[model samples]
Target: MKKEILGGLRFFLLMTVLCGGVYTLAVTGVAQLVFPHQANGSLMKEDSKVIGSSLIGQNFTDESYFHGRPSEVSQLSPYASEYKEMITERTQAIQEENGSTSAVPADLVMGSASGIDPHISVAGANYQAKRIADSRNVEIQRINDIIEANKEKDLLTGNEYINVLVVNAALNRLE
Candidate 1:
């Protein structure tokens, strides 16, 4: 019985070292070697200063900048009254901000699945173009062009998305 107990102890130690230490190191090393940019949090930089990560959303309430989707750290249930009320409020706010009577895009009113998604649907970006243009005192065409340039297509769905941070950065660069 003592010998059996010793054997089990050895097995446990071996697995703890192999799985906890060695496996973790191997995966991290592979990630660093193969995808260094992503492994490093996909940070965006400006003038050698870290601005933000491309993988995370930022809250921009300034009228001069385009806004991202509503961020909810914990998503409310779709059937909940709070969720319905929040959606209604967001839709009204977007309409008022953009001076649009058109229906607001779903992305504008809904929180993203991750709640930290940096990208918004292309339509969502365009919906705010007028406000951004007015605030920046630039032509609407310029804002649209910037949106066009930064738009990315999803691999599976082929739907276009624009990173709000990138678009806002481009807006800042406008002379």
Candidate 2:
């Protein structure tokens, strides 16, 4: 019984150190070397100030900026229909601000599963292109060009996606 107890204790300690310490360090080291930007939360900067990250979303309610989907961190929970209504009303208000006849894209009114997805669908970006252009006093064609330039194609399906934060950053640079 003594020998069995000792053996079990040794195995548990060995596995804990090996799995919790060595393996974690090894994987983290490899990730740091291979994908330093992504491994470090894909943070984005402006004027050397860390404005946000490429992996998370934030509210963009101003008329001049292209908005991401409504964040779940609102007074009404994301699952509630009232929350969706709020998103719809906001999008429509922006559309009205720009006098855009085009309908609002679905993604703009719906939050991503993570509630803070940086990427918006291609359709979502284009839907706001006119509004952004009008508010910025830039040509619509130029806005479309910026959208196309920022699109990221899916590896498996080849569908286009846009990173909202990056695109907004690029737009800020246009000024």
Candidate 3:
């Protein structure tokens, strides 16, 4: 009985080390090496200061900068009410005005799970072009051209998405 219990303890310890420590380290190391860019790309450096992450979107309200898709994520309202109430009220208003069913596009309704999605629908990007152009004192044609240039081809079918971070980076490079 004593021998059996000792053997069982040893087996459990060996399995824990193999499955938890060794496996986790091996997989993580390999993943980091295989996707180095993705692992490091989240860090954004600006003027020697880490400004933000490319993985998340910042709230850019200035007309000079392009706007991202509408965010459905809401904070605590000044009024004391349930969080769901706020969302329901806003969603109901939108549905009544737009006549959209509950099947609204993912981008149009709920915020990204990460709350920092850097990609926007092509339509959302285009919608902000005019405002951006006007704010930058640039020609609308020029802005339209930029949007067209950055437009992504349909990957599988008709779904096209623009990486906002990439486009904004390119825009900064423009003279």
**Model 2 off-target regions past 4 Å?**
73-91
- For each candidate in turn, the TM-score is 0.88, 0.80, 0.64
Query: What order do candidates take by lDDT, descending?
Result: 1, 2, 3
By lDDT, the better pick of 1 and 3 is 1
At residue 91, candidate 1 shows an lDDT of 97
Task: In model 2, state the lDDT of residue 159.
Answer: 82
> Tens digit of lDDT per residue, candidate 3, span 48-115?
77756767777665556665555555565536566557656656754553444443344534466566
Per-model root-mean-square deviation over C-alphas:
2.0, 3.4, 6.9
Alpha carbon lDDT at 121, candidate 3: 76
lDDT of 2 by residue, 1-175 (tens): 9999999999999999999999999999999999999999899999999878988887887878778876674656778998878887877875786577677776776667778878878988888788788889989898898899999999999888898889999999988
Residue range with the least summed lDDT across 10 consecutive positions in model 2: 69-78
Poorest lDDT segment (10 consecutive residues) of candidate 1: 69-78
Off by over 4 Å in 1: 73-82
Candidate 3 lDDT at 170 equals 56
Q: How many residue pairs clash (N, CA or C atoms closer than 3 angstroms) in each of the candidate models, in the order given? A: 0, 0, 0
